[model samples]
Target: MAAKRDKRGLSQYRNEYLAAIAATFSLLATVAAAGWSSPAIPALKQDDSPVPITANQGSWIVSILSIGSLFGPIITGLAVDRYGPKRTLLLSVIPLAIGWVIIVFASNVHIIYAARFLHGISYGTAYSVTPIYLGEISSNAIRGSTGVLITVMAKFAFLLEYSIGPYVDFRSLAWISLTFPVIFFILFFWMPESPYYLLAHNRDKEALSTLRWLRRSDESSEQIEKEFTQMKALVQKTQHDESSLNNLFARSNRKSLGIILLLSCGMQLTGINAILGYAQTIFSKLEMELNAAELSIILASVQLIAVFIPTFFVDRAGRRPLLLLSTGGSLFALIACSVYFTFDAFDYPTETLSWVPFVSTLGFIVSFALGLATVPFAILSEIFPKSIKANANAVFAMVTSLVVFVVVKLFQVISDSAGTYVSFWIFSGCTACTGVLIHFFIPETRGKSFEEIQEIMTVESSSKEKTKCLPLLC
Candidate 1:
């Protein structure tokens, strides 16, 4: 009986793990879609008519998708909270598939923009909802690892697209991206609703049944019951004062929300997306001049390699240190790139100037993948209480998407007017400041329970409040 119980527990967890991995296919799809056109330089230029897309216009087309993504989190949050992740996830895929179809057949810039916007919505919701679902279902022991695993998969998808994009037509890349949601939609229908969601709606029997399925055995009723009891207690204690958009800025919750939002904003300001979006151009400025396919492969491969740095250290080094290190490293790389550009602008020898920017670009990718890329979602998932996790995640996704949109657009404009070197310097400055802010404000959150993390944030906020309230004499 004891041996059987252990085996059952392992089996249940395996099923849950498989579901988690399947859910991440949405992320993979998002990456593949986002990067599909990035490596198709010849096609992009060839497709242009009498009035070609300027650098800025090209960036705008790419950046406009973020505009759509900005609203996805908020909308999906409400949907997920009301209907549960199962329905929300299933529905989210429709927009992604539709967006791909549009991109695959797009003839005009306007059509591409429309398709991108739709894709943005799907991307935003998936980014927000996946974590909420993962966190709700995962045991605390593996939550952080599971969250990072999704990111790793996302990076791999990006790399895969980059590697293959050059060899195929842009339309084919869109078709490949469509495969994920199709698979996810089919497989996900059979997966269980989040146990937390079931309990939230007072569906005890159903929650238990789902737990049994997740655990892969009908045994361990007592343990499962205990877990449910604890969940019930937590829900009862916190449900009355649960967070909503209106109360997100409430006195008790505002500090945590601020931390999460700032951290998210910091992630974007690190220039990861801006660089990735313009990787081909950046390489050109560096004097490397890789063909579109080669550039894509390099960028994707770097992104894939860099993610491992965080994966190995996140659980060991804690969040704040890794964030600080990555940000600082990125700042250094940006400064190096800027210096190289400054030289090039002044007519420095081509051979010397070229390699400087190339080296710096590699450093920037390393820094980004090591820290900023993996941490934002992980931190967001941890900071919010269960009651507000969905809304908070939505809010985070919206803000991140909006910031990415602005940054991508701004980088393009600056690159067009001021040159790539000057543009990167600005990014460097932002990253340097981000490092400082993270060091001072963000808390370390490795190995802590959800309740413990909440307590830490709560106590820190309370202490700050009291310090502000103290009189001059006291």
Candidate 2:
């Protein structure tokens, strides 16, 4: 059974709505700062007439950012658990701002690489910390939507950079990116820390205060207290173990870890990043006549439109069904592209083959926005126990960055050597495998409470028998 919800009046819901908007804005600021730098990297590489930086060298610079981001989650997870989200977020802005400054002034490929690595750390920390903060502060009824809001905001950031990066100089784009971090630093000072974190650390009075501020009424006091007690109990249950990191892989946690890791990995294998990162090159190979700027605008518009589909239906339609639909849709799109490419390999006319790749790419993007892009973090946030949520999230982020790095790098080599059709086929195979895994292993989490989710995951039962377990803690 789902946990009972706190009854807030319409006025209170309004306040919560305002707070969610504020949190979304904060997230957008950080994401814009991190993502804007990426679109500029390709441009910087091609700025050879002015100054030479090979495309491969530019890619290396971008890859280093992912490497640096791999560390952000681990470091910020500990900090967020200890000092709270507000402070950790405040600290994150410094590196983001500095990294942009470095990128703006960088004279050579090596300097760009160093700048990206530094920015990666900021990106990593922000990704983990912001979601944790949002999850903690948001009402359960709106939690999934709140998580999607972050994804939506990040997509907007990506779109923003893609649309504008081509028009402006790389240095100017880097400067524009700096504005987000500056505003984040300024506004984050007023934002509240996660009340859940306070309770975890035994700061009960402060936790109550935060609840009051966030909830804006005494009506939820009982519910807030109940939640605090539950969090405290969970923390105590898990506190005795000194090995915080390894606890994620402990026997009891294995299923939870498995679900998170597989889902995280599946997210990358959907090939959304591969599509977005290489959209222009893919279009060029298809014999499309559009320039870089025109292609980027089209790509960005498609992504932006696709994001709205999930935003509207994610809550009502449920996670598992949407995931299945997304996987199947993406597979169809990829296979179509593969078939078209195969036809081209046999000397199909350019006029015939040109539109095939274009339509295939659009279908792939739409499918991804519907499925992999929307649900990975949503599922992750619900699956893990609060005690290990941060650490597990860090691990998830690290794995995602690693996969993206490998996929992006591999896509480049394979697309260059083997051709576009082979690349699409590879991604198609991955999506098919992910669909099979989801069908057999992934649980339906929509409309379920965190505690209900824990019980469902921990209990073992016969395939034909439904298991009814108590909430794991509280």
lDDT against the true structure, each candidate? 0.75, 0.73
Write candidate 2's Cα lDDT for 1-474 as tens digits: 123343434356565555555555555655664455346656665636244676576556545667888988988777977888778877876777888898788787677777778787887888777777777786666666667776777777777777878788888888888887777677667777777787777887887787777777674578767766776676676566444887787756677777777778888876667667665556656566776557767777887789778866776788888888988988898899888887786676667567777777778778888867777767777777777888888988899889878877777777768876787788889989989887777778777877788887674645443332222210
Best by TM-score: 1
Per-residue accuracy of model 1 over 340-391 as CA lDDT, tens digit each:
7777777877675566666677788888877787776667778777788888
TM-score for each model? 0.90, 0.89
Q: What is the number of backbone collisions in each predicted candidate, taken in the order shown?
A: 1, 1
lDDT of 1 at 72: 77
TM-score of 1: 0.90
Pairs that collide, model 2? 69-120
Span of ten consecutive residues with least summed lDDT in model 2: 465-474
Highest lDDT among the candidates is held by which one?
1
Q: What is the number of residue pairs that collide in model 1?
A: 1
